[model samples]
Target: MGIILMFMLLASVTPFLFLQLKKTVFALVQTILLVGMWLYFFEVVFQAAPAAFSIPWIMFYASLFVAEVGWVMFIIRLIKTSSTVQESFQ
Candidate 1:
């Protein structure tokens, strides 16, 4: 009980703080990822909602791993959008 509450609080608060500091696309993505990951943890321990062998269940589990992919894609996109030199020709 206590452990679940502690994790829940941490999961919700950290992303909220980031969003407060920076209301941007990255902040929104982070909020979704963190909350989704928290839901995954809750389901893992409590067996709530979706059954063990279902797509939603798999998605809940996937949230645990998607953080890396999200960040990597964000970084790659950021690089792609950045200018190569000090100024643009167009």
Candidate 2:
């Protein structure tokens, strides 16, 4: 329960946390939604406990997958915009 709540909070806040990357907000939100849904499925559908679960791999893969996708999209958008701005100066 608590674990799920914490993840939910993180999902909600992650987008705002990276406000510097305005274009990334959408990607961050998508990732958050995916994470949140997966967590809910595990907690509700599978009824997993928040005990000392020794599943580091699950956490690592899930978190990194979402974050990696978001980061890649963010970098792409940032580069595209910066290039456009540079081109405008010429």
Candidate 3:
């Protein structure tokens, strides 16, 4: 139940995150991965993927990879865009 909800949340939020980093090479790669992630999600959900594929394990790992990469990039961009720097400790 909770896992399904988290899946829905990630699907909802991914595109909005992409919009934050437009017109760059990293953004392009992120877009490709984003599309692939959702494509796999939909294919597996609809049972459109091939019969021999190990659906659950592959989807689990792919989901984690996509989520991690996306959020890490977002956080890095967030820090880069911050209005102030962290205080230096001498």
Q: Which stretches of candidate 1 lie over 4 Å from their true place?
A: 1-4, 48-90
For candidate 3, list the clashing residue pairs, or say none.
Answer: none
**What would the per-residue lDDT of candidate 1 be over residues 16-89, giving only the tens digit for each residue?**
44454454665566566666666666766797566675654554445434444444555565566675532475
lDDT tens per residue, model 2, 20-61: 566465656555555645564466556754434334335434
TM-score of each prediction? 0.38, 0.42, 0.45
What is the alpha-carbon lDDT for the whole of candidate 1? Answer: 0.55
- Using lDDT as the measure, which candidate wins? 3
Candidate 2: which stretches are off by over 4 Å?
A: 1-14, 17-60
Q: How high a TM-score does candidate 2 get?
A: 0.42
The most accurate candidate by TM-score is: 3
List the lowest-lDDT window of 10 residues for candidate 2.
Answer: 51-60
lDDT of 3: 0.59
